[model samples]
Target: MTITTTLEPVTGPFVWRGDELSRTDDWIFRLGPDQVAELEEVGRRFIADDPDLRTVSAAQYPLTAAAEAIRRFGADMDSGRGFVLIRGLRMEEYDDTLAAAIFYLIGLHLGEPIRQNELGDLIDHIVGVSDKAYEEGGLPSRTRDKLPYHSDSSDAVALMCLRPPASGGLSSLVSGATVFNELLARRPDLAPLLLEPWHYDWRRQDPDAPADTYTSPIVSWTQGCFSMYAGADMIESAHRYPGVPPLTGPQREALALIEEITYSDGVALDMDFQPGDIQWLLNYAALHSRTEFVNGADFAHTRHLLRLWLRRDVGRPLVENFGKHVVVDRSSTRTEDAVRDTQGHFRIREAAAVRTDWGD
Candidate 1:
């Protein structure tokens, strides 16, 4: 199936200033006070119902209620901006265990409720985070980090902020579909290259997977819906292989064009996250980015957030070679560590190595 970009002119450009994006009357989803209270109550019960669910790890929680919430609300949720951020749903005073539980519950509510093992499988294929550290690393922390716009290994990705940065670390987003549409309208010749398969470095992969790379297209069409996976770093790495040809001038130009649109006012959105606020987005439909941030003076006061990748029940089909951990059939699963190692090649040499004091 050929995926086409559906570029429609933006009614208005998204403006970002500090931690807040401009408010729109056309939000895809907004939680009322009643809904927020209900969600909190559900979170409290979720912890109480499963004593074994709390831990520092993202994978430790039982996600029954949270999954049910996604199953109930995901389809009704808006896809444009292709995201939602629910502010003011406090759970900060709770212990790490309770906080983790709350994060999992919120994820379950907004996403398809798959087992932690399933989440691990996707992480192994995408972010390469192992199952053991999933819970701890799932939360946000203030640090000089640069994550480009790329899709997670799931239909949707969600993050619940427990704290905001003392400075910097703003979240940015752009719609891949919107970019494609614009390119199609202005540069039709370049569209085909985006739909063709490209290689990715799998930089987060464990050493045992062979010093090779994985391949997939930036744009894919399955079940009549469009999906994308575009990251310039990964795309450039593919050229190192003997058989792979370099990206054509037009292809490179197309990528640059998309990046320009993404960074511009027409398609991008930026916001500072606050405690108790949860942001959920369609992974394939949008590109997400984060700015580097500084840490507070104390460890306990550092910025932190919890994240999850979810497979929506009603979403499009997986293209071949797209989901490496699970069969395209979606019938099997494994622990994230078993499928692949989560540790990156880079390691901190000392305690201060983890500090975010350097310039971006």
Candidate 2:
């Protein structure tokens, strides 16, 4: 698909103003030298105090301090800059388990903490990396590779870089609001089509359940706020199931326009991640992507990152058609039935969850 919309250059800092977007310094925050040092020290000690850290599978931290940092740094959906990419944090120095633990700790400090078990389930759903594969591969394919632009089940999402790609893996971000604004200005007639629900193919399904597809709006507005979830492959897959509507020509046009706007310099921000860097974003507010990359030949040198999907207690409501599967309780787990073939370069293994060496 091709986008025909002409776009204006993005100026000013990216800021979220209600449901709209603008550029402003108020929404952007950077950690100072002292804070960065404090964070590193805290991370180091957390690993040291819990020597079985790699085996440990629980969230252990002071909630007040973590919440304070999140509030101060503007880590909410309404805060509009939508994303923050922290550089200089390296994950390779620690073991995979410790690396994941560190990510969990820092993420807990950033938002309302969810249990490790719940986190584990969510991770399994998002990445589908089983316990055995985690032991062997060290991480899942979705995370180990350059993840495409997609939103996870959260108001805010974060990733801590443990081991970065040896070469050619850069993080990219685009504002959904920016794309909508560009569309509203350039192609007013197609704007409303995006506000309606579109089908999504849930590729990561369990074996027992029937193959099912879900529907969600690519763009939606509620209480004067807007949210979105747009992915080319996922949206196209929805039609495979019975009773789902096909993509309309205008919807296709709008999606193509969105791709153009997001990839263009006018709406996108690109950065190369360094080891130890932590990147977080308001998932509903921003669309993110990564460039394809190659891991080093050695297992020790392979690229790895830890991810967390956080529900912002203070976040806005999802449009009615979106968020159908977003159950509030942490215990809910829905499996998909999409089959996997071994044709790709990478291999995917199916295994059950295992008890971590670190006791809960």
The most accurate candidate by TM-score is: 2
For 209-240, candidate 1 gives per-residue lDDT tens digits of 34456777887755556666777655776677
Query: For model 1, what is the error of residue 191's alpha carbon versus the real structure, in angstroms, after optimal superposition?
Result: 0.9
Stretches > 4 Å off in candidate 1: 1-38, 48-73, 76-81, 110-143, 205-211, 241-244, 317-319, 322-360
RMSD after CA superposition, every candidate: 8.2, 8.9
Kindly list the per-residue Cα lDDT of model 2 for residues 234-341, writing each as its tens digit.
Answer: 576567677877778887888787777766654566666666667787777777777766667774445555556666655566677574343332323334421211
lDDT of 2 at 333: 34
- Local accuracy by lDDT, each model: 0.52, 0.53
Q: What's the true lDDT of residue 209 in model 1?
A: 36
Query: What is the model-wide C-alpha lDDT for candidate 2?
Result: 0.53
